[model samples]
Target: MAEETITLEVTRYRPREDREPRAQAFTVPYRKDWVVLDALNHIKDRVDGTLTYRWSCRMGVCGSCGMMVNGVPKLTCAAFLRDYLPGPIRVEPLAYFPVIRDLVVDIEDFMGKLRRVMPWIIRRTEQPLTAGEYRQTPAQLEAYKQFSMCINCMLCYAACPVYGLSPLFIGPAAIALGYRYNLDSRDEGYHLRQPILAEAVGVWQCTFVGECSAVCPKGVDPAAAIQRSKVAGAKDWFLSILLPRGGRS
Candidate 1:
């Protein structure tokens, strides 16, 4: 018997050429184990060279080749063509982001917002780099260590409705990084930067829809991070009023 063939309907956009983005169809022969990335590569190499997308660490570690496949945000490298139902699979750039070309979306807005959250450890005292590594207990490390799994795939932002409405919302991925570091016992930015995170479009902006977490390929719980931040923010506020000296100083 001959091998089965799959058809892919990919969205294409060229600012200097097309009036707007449009879908292009490509039918290609495929093996059972070939992933979506393989199908895209097949289209690019044999079918059409104009189709554009991003990819690296095709093993799903790089988190670069994320897009909307069949109306869901997922990593192309991890999404298999065999598992998907037969027919023309629709491939488009991630949602809630500006499309730069075919399947590539402008990620600068996402990166810029990530910087606003100061996703790093801010120490009260400048710890000498020469100083030996800051040791952390198993318990302390375990608390926030899970969040370190974030690969910044940007799928969270794509799946986020808040990001669609407010591009400057400093959406899920960066906020997850914030909670990751804030939970570290050695980190001091938690209290100092609390106000910055308390903005209307900041951590409070997260409504815990769980969509971000749902589409995450790395299992990074952006929703959990937002929830924890909310709880921490409230706790800090209550303690500030209860103890005159224990508050943000």
Candidate 2:
């Protein structure tokens, strides 16, 4: 009896060496328990030392192992080899981003967008140290809990077609994060974040293709967040018309 093997057609590109990206296949032993990241580790450790990719926690919590598995954005750590059985699994860098090297895309754009969204609790006035903490009920926590599950994975950006067409779009994860903070009961930065979320490149840029929600591994529905933000933006705009000095809280 012979051991079964699987083929992985991985993308290879060296900026100084290769003119463009190309596929390089490698055959490895097929283990039902092995994930795509495991196979990649095997290649880097044994077969080819030059194969480069990013992976931190193999547990899929770090979101650093996101890549294109069979043309869909996925965390390689969660992608099982047995799922794509009996043959080659096409692996590439996440779509709609500039490839820095083989299976590594430049995420500076996403980082910048994330910063602009201000994904943190903000208060106009700070409470005194002796004032204790701003507490919330479990119901209040549940308001923005689902959107807070983002691991900063670029998977949503890769899955978004609007991002592919328009790079200036604020993107799914960033907007969802902004909405998350806005929904926080203790957060008083809605006025501060409104400009960014209501801008042309903000929630309006998302065409609601729904792929961002579809590919989310954390179950974060960024598509719903975008839609909800759009509604909130509209309500604020209408309130601004009615009340000259005040809009939304």
Best-fitting candidate, scored by lDDT: 2
Residue 147 of model 2, lDDT score: 95
Q: What is the lDDT of residue 221 in candidate 1?
A: 91
The global C-alpha lDDT for each of the candidates, from Candidate 1 onward, is 0.86, 0.94
Worst ten-residue run, lDDT, model 2? Answer: 240-249
C-alpha-based local distance difference test score of model 1: 0.86
Clash pairs for candidate 1? none
Per model, how many backbone clashes are there? 0, 0
**What lDDT score goes with residue 161 in model 2?**
91
| lDDT minimum window of 10 residues, candidate 1 | 190-199
Cα TM-score of candidate 1? 0.93
Off by over 4 Å in 1: 238-246
